[model samples]
Target: MSSLTVAYAVAFYVAAAVLVLGLVVKIKQYATTPSPLKIPTMPAPRTRLGVVLRILREVIYFESLFKSNKWIWICAVLFHAGLWLVLARHLRYFIEPVWFWVVLVQPFGIYAGFAMIAGLVALWARRIVVNRVRYISGPSDHLMLALLVGIGFSGMMLRFVERTDIIAVKAFFLGLLRFDLQPLPAEMPLLVHLGLVITLMIVFPFSKLLHVPGVFFSPSRAQVDDAREKRHLAPWAAKLDAERDSAAAE
Candidate 1:
């Protein structure tokens, strides 16, 4: 019940609220935006089921990224795969009885942290070294990468260089979930990692990180290539057509 604990607890709760609410609002907007054109990328799926499968492949395998650039794809895949494993392993901290699968992945998660850092570094380097990418890169892009790299490096330091009281960390998080604030460990590395994580959560909804959810709503990816087979009309356009017909009849 120290002031530090209270501050962190409040920060985390506020960050979580912002993250969830922001994503909800953004997703609603994406869903409601009408696409009046059947403009899927070339070689796109013709059927709805096929589009679903295509999107799955894009999400799971980064198919388009792979086709576009091999090195970038490799780095992205490594980072994302490592991130998933690390996140799954973190379930041990939040849940009471750790799931068997989470327990099984615990060891791999440690190594995954290394891979995540490596991939992030490579990606950042690409933004700096590649002229085309660097030209388009802005301050926010670099800052985002720095933030993620800081998070991964601090987390790795906590695990390898200076081990903290993980039990206390788990208790803190679990307490937060139950509306009970517990004292967070005062370890510098752990504090840095947690702070960065909270910052990421708060900024995620407004940042390019939104591409995670935005991908699903992309008209180019979500729409089926049926322009040839049927007329495509937005909801507003359809309403206009209906009004026009009514006026003509009158």
Candidate 2:
């Protein structure tokens, strides 16, 4: 294996370790029995119609995304859109190419590539300019953005200006899809492209990218927020409370 490949493998493993360990530690910390913090709750909107509207607002608008800073929201939305499109385009590699979709993919792929790079640059600029984002931003956060931007930029380069050997790239990917490691492409540029792609995949499940699923797992978003007024505690919580009451009475 080339030194570049070895370096990518090492970085991927390290990033994976940090992600897994960090998540485990966070889960364990949250699991330990402790009294909940008594932070004052915000005054919920009044009236039946208004409360429903408020809940809809939070779910659809991603209110939390913008609470921190304007640029952060922009970068986040653009990055997400770009990443989605890029992934969508990759479906061509896995599936037999249909002419219509293949033709459609190029335009959107270019747009997504530009958007991803632009968003990353804007985010990095915000990190440098905004006091709070800069203060709170860790090295890993910066590294993640840089890596994403690099991947998009390199991909766009290969697609448009300096067309790499498409045949070789296709074969390499098809081999991967088939659970085989085809011999590395003869061209160093192709190897570099594959290197970045593999690096991103290996790091994906570990990083904040994991938050793609974490968002759904979140209690605040996934759980019903109207529970205080609309519904009782889960049967489990209720049954535990009843057992405690019975024990006390005895």
* Each prediction's whole-model lDDT (CA): 0.92, 0.64
Worst 10 residues of 1 by lDDT: 35-44
User: What range of 10 consecutive residues in model 2 has the weakest lDDT sum?
Assistant: 33-42
Model 2: per-residue Cα lDDT over 1-250, one tens digit each: 4564345445545655665676666555544423232121345443446555555555455577678667677886777678777877766765556456666875787798788788888988888898987998899999887877777777777787778766655655565556554444455555566567666666766577766545533444433334455544544467788999999999
Quote model 2's TM-score.
0.69
Taking all chains together, each candidate's TM-score versus the true structure is: 0.95, 0.69
lDDT of 1 by residue, 30-65 (tens): 999898767788888999999999899999999999
Q: Which candidate number maximizes TM-score?
A: 1
lDDT of the structure predicted as candidate 1: 0.92
Query: For residue 62, what is the lDDT in candidate 1?
Result: 97
